[model samples]
Target: MRFVSWNVNGIRACVKKGFLDYFHKVDADIFCIQESKLQEGQIQLELEGYEQYWNYAERKGYSGTAIFTKIKPLSVSYGVGDLDTEAEGRIITLEFESFYFITMYTPNSKRDLARLDERLEWEDAIRTYLLQLEQVKPVILCGDLNVAHQEIDLKNPKSNRGNSGFTVEEREKMTKLLDAGFVDSFRYKYPEKTDAFTWWSYMSKVRERNIGWRIDYFIVSSSLADKIGDAQIHSEVLGSDHCPILLELEQ
Candidate 1:
């Protein structure tokens, strides 16, 4: 089975930039997207053979997530606990016969670190939620997690050390989550590989220079580690500042 994740900045804008073309070409079993930045009835996507599930933020043109899967899930859920009432439209969970698939658009601590506390709280809640889900079945967690877990995950790590996404506290939270029994599929596959990034700054020549951060991920329950077949950062296929990442599992 193949799973793909990408933060499409805004689904509408991404479509004009060939999102559909790449979407068709990849033909993923499940496709997850974050930062959709649209409300319900804003735009309709004609995706053949795929069941579309969307979580739109209450605040129009803001953070949102969506999942398109060829296989219909046994059950579908939105948000984690009381999070649905908060209205950021950050998470979606789908339960299949074998596992639970989750796509999340993690809240970003603003550049000034203004939202750091809230972001940390979110991490804690999400970790607990995943652990609870694992008690039932393995989980496939993906989307823009919004943090670079280690120095190896981004370019110029020293300069970005205390930045919003690279703060020690944020990174440690990610470490704690992994230590709790989840595996980051890409890093697990190629530990030493550098310049493998999923999101890049839209600033001048940033993406061109590959100055990016691997903030997006496919983290699976440790039990599914051996089932991981291939983990890829599709840096070449672009629409948003973030590119698609693919995870293939051995059937």
Candidate 2:
């Protein structure tokens, strides 16, 4: 199976920049997107054979996520069970016969780290939730997790050390999550690939210089590690500050 994930930043704006063109060209079985930033009835997409599932933020033009899949899932859920989530449309879980596919939009702590505590709480809750689901079946989770997991994940880790997405607390939380039972698919495949970043700053010449962070990911249950095939960062694709990452699974 082939899967692709991207943080569109804003779906509407991204569409104007040839999102559909790339979307058709990629032709992933499952296409997941984060940071949609739209409300219900705001925009309509005509993706021929793909079924669209969107989790819109309660606040208009804010955090949101969606999944466009050619294969229909057995069931679909939004957010962690009974958790105070998805008010910002941060997550969605689609259940198939063999696995649970989740697309997440992790909350950012903001420039001042004002939402740090809330972000930490979310990490804990999501970890617990994923573990519980892992007990039943493997999970394939993807999206803009909003953290540069390690020094190699960002261009200048030393300079970004205490920044919101690269902070010790944030990075450590990601470590704990992976340690729990998940595998960071790309890093597992290419541990030494320093230049394969997914999200770049929109500042002048930042993307051109390849000064970016691999904040987006395709994390799967350890059990699925053997199924992982080619994991790629399509850094050349442009629409948002982030590019699309693809993962292939083989039986």
Candidate 3:
């Protein structure tokens, strides 16, 4: 089975940039997207043979996520649990026969670290939620986690050390999540590779320079580690500030 995750930035903008072409070419068993920046019925996609699920933020053009899967899940859920307060559309969970798939648009800690506290709270709640799901079945967690976990993940690591996505605190939360039993598929496959990134800053043609962050990911419960076959970053696929990441498993 193959799973792909990407932060398209905006679905409408991505469509203009050949999103459908890439989507057809990739043809993943399941595709997860984050930072969709649109509400229900705002855009129409003709994805045959795929069941589409979307969660929209209360605020327009804000954070959101969606999943298109060839496999029909036993059940689908929106948000983490609390539907009223969980209006950011940050999470969506799909229960398959053997596993649970979760796509998340993790909150970003703003430039001034203004949202650091909220980000931490989100981390806590999300981690607990993931663990709870893990108890029931192996979990595939993917999407824009919003943090570049290590020095190998981004260019200019020293300068970006305290930046929003690279802050020590944010990285630690990712570490804690992995420690709790998740395996970052790409890192697990290529632990020492450099210049391998999934997201790039839009400033000053940074993407052309290959100055980017490996923030989007496909992570799974440690139990599925042995089943992993290949993990890749589709760096050349243009559409958003982020590119798609792929994970293939024997499962």
Candidate 4:
């Protein structure tokens, strides 16, 4: 089965930038998005054969997520338990017969680190939520997790050390998540590969120079690790500052 995740940055903006073309070309069984920044009746996506699920932030044009799945799930849910109380519309979970797929737009610890505490609380809540799902069946969790777990996951690690997404505390939360029971699929396949990234800064040729952070991810429960065929970062396909990450797994 093929599953894909992309932070479209903004759905309306992406639609104008060949999103449909890329969507048709990829033809994934499931496609998920983060940072949609939209609400009901704002836009329409015509993806045939895909069941669309969207979680919109209560605040207009803010953080949000969506999922388009070819296979209809047995059940669907929004948010990570009490974390949904934040009103940022950050999570969506689709439960299939065999596994659960969750897409999240993790909170960013703003430039000034003013939201660091909230982000940490969100991390803990989401981790517990994933663990609960894993107890029932294997889980595939993917999205713009908003943190680079290690130096290897980004370029210029020393310079970005204490930055919001690359902070030691944020990275440790990611480490704890993986240590709990999940496998970072890309790193599992390419343990030492460097300079590969998902989100790039849209400033001063940073994207052109490939100065980016691997903040997006496709993480699965350890039991599903062996089923992973390939984990890909499509850096070239761009409408947003973030590109799509693909995961191919044996059915």
C-alpha lDDT score of every prediction, in listed order: 0.94, 0.94, 0.92, 0.93
lDDT of 4 by residue, 148-238 (tens): 9989999999988899998999999999999999999999999999999999988989999999999999999999999999999999998
Tens-place lDDT digits, model 2, residues 1-251: 99999999999999999999999999999999999999989999999999999999999899999999999999999989877786989999999989999999999999999999999999999999999999999999999999999899999999888999999999999999999989999999998988889988889999999998999999999999999998999999999999999999996
For residues 1-251, what per-residue lDDT tens digits would candidate 3 score against the true structure? 99999899999999999999999999999998998999999999999999999999999999899999999999999887653425888889999999999999988899999999999888888889999999999999999988999998988899888999999899999999999999999989988989999988789989999988899989899999999999999999999999999999996
TM-score of every candidate relative to the true structure: 0.98, 0.98, 0.97, 0.98
lDDT of 1 by residue, 2-66 (tens): 99999999999999999999999999999999999999999999999999999999998999999
Task: Supply candidate 4's per-residue lDDT for 4.
Answer: 94
Residue 5 displacement (Å), model 1: 0.5
lDDT of 3: 0.92
The TM-score obtained by model 2 is: 0.98
| Candidate 4 global lDDT | 0.93
lDDT order of candidates, top first? 1, 2, 4, 3
The deviation in Å at residue 177 for candidate 4 is: 0.7
